[model samples]
Target: MVRGKIEIKKIENRTSRQITFSKRRNGLFKKAHELSVLCDAQVAAIVFSQSGRLYEFSSSEMEKTIERYVKFSPDYFVPGRPQVELYLLELKKEMDIMVKKIDLLEVHQRKLMGQGLGSCSLAQLQGLETQIEKSLRIIRSRKAELYADQLLKLKEKERELLDQRRRLREEEIRETLVRPMLPVTLHTGKDETGSACRMSKHSSEVETDLFIGFPATRL
Candidate 1:
């Protein structure tokens, strides 16, 4: 009959448990040695019996393997100290300092904006006033620059508008020059007074100051 597989559980008998521990510890050491030799791998194993006896296996020196483990597996190498946790602790401390600095800066900004002045001392208030004066100077300087820029832009726009007007006037003059002029014929007749009178066919009924408002035309 074939032997059945053993169900793994804690051995209840003390003597049996001790025997099992001894056998398993030796077997584990043997397996570790075989794996190291077969795979050309660095291996280390440590065990402690219930009686507080140390058992260990290593492909090379135990200290050397441990050093390698610590080097590669820095996170779980030492029980008391974790390198990653130490770095994170330092980072957290730096973050806390930065947060405090930001908070102080925010309070300073609030004071500069004329808020939160109730908690300030006389000297603090004076310092804030100086800062406000400095800020005002800077603001005035920037404002002047902006005004200058706006004036320059306005001047540029004015020049552009003038150039456009000039171009339009030149175009109008060109069209006028190219136009064909109409010939005028004067017809003398006797009016109600029976005096010599002249009438123009092209003249409108409403009179205009032709010399002042219109170009001189050939009569």
Candidate 2:
């Protein structure tokens, strides 16, 4: 017969209860073993009966198996492991703690998640808002200070470069003032006819003006 279903509340008959507990305990352990074998699970089961006796089974090292059942990811774990979700039942018992004693996130949750303290005053909101505003102000001030320092350093560098260019130009001007200057090209001289004409252009900037000094040919 399929005898898996049974009453859940207190058993009025002590002997019947004892018998049921033994039967169920054996069945439970058998099921645990079957599950471990069938699913290739590293499983552990621990039972403490009404008589305070312990019965346990582990498919692998009991500690390792149990630890695997309580793994946590990184993000939700603010200060420690996020495995506190595993302790939900325990946390529920201590739900009535003083507001100051809880975590900031928990308080934030209560405030935002509609699960926080029953009464929040306008003054409290004002205080929290004030802190937020102050934090923003401090951040902005620090950013401005950093920006000012960077701008000052950049301006200093720019000034240094400008001064270097100015010094180079002044040195060049001084060298030009001291060095021998190249002779300049002259305009064309007139022939006996007093006409200005283009001359034989040489590779040099120095030009020569030829006069037909005194006419060499006469008719």
lDDT of candidate model 2 versus the reference: 0.70
lDDT of 2 by residue, 51-127 (tens): 54556788888655544555554444455654555554444444433224456556865665446445778887676
What's the TM-score of every candidate structure?
0.44, 0.37
TM-score of 2: 0.37
lDDT of 2 at 68: 53
Candidate 2, position 116, lDDT: 49
Model 2: weakest 10-residue lDDT segment is 194-203
lDDT value, residue 36 of candidate 1: 97
> Clashes in candidate 1: how many?
0
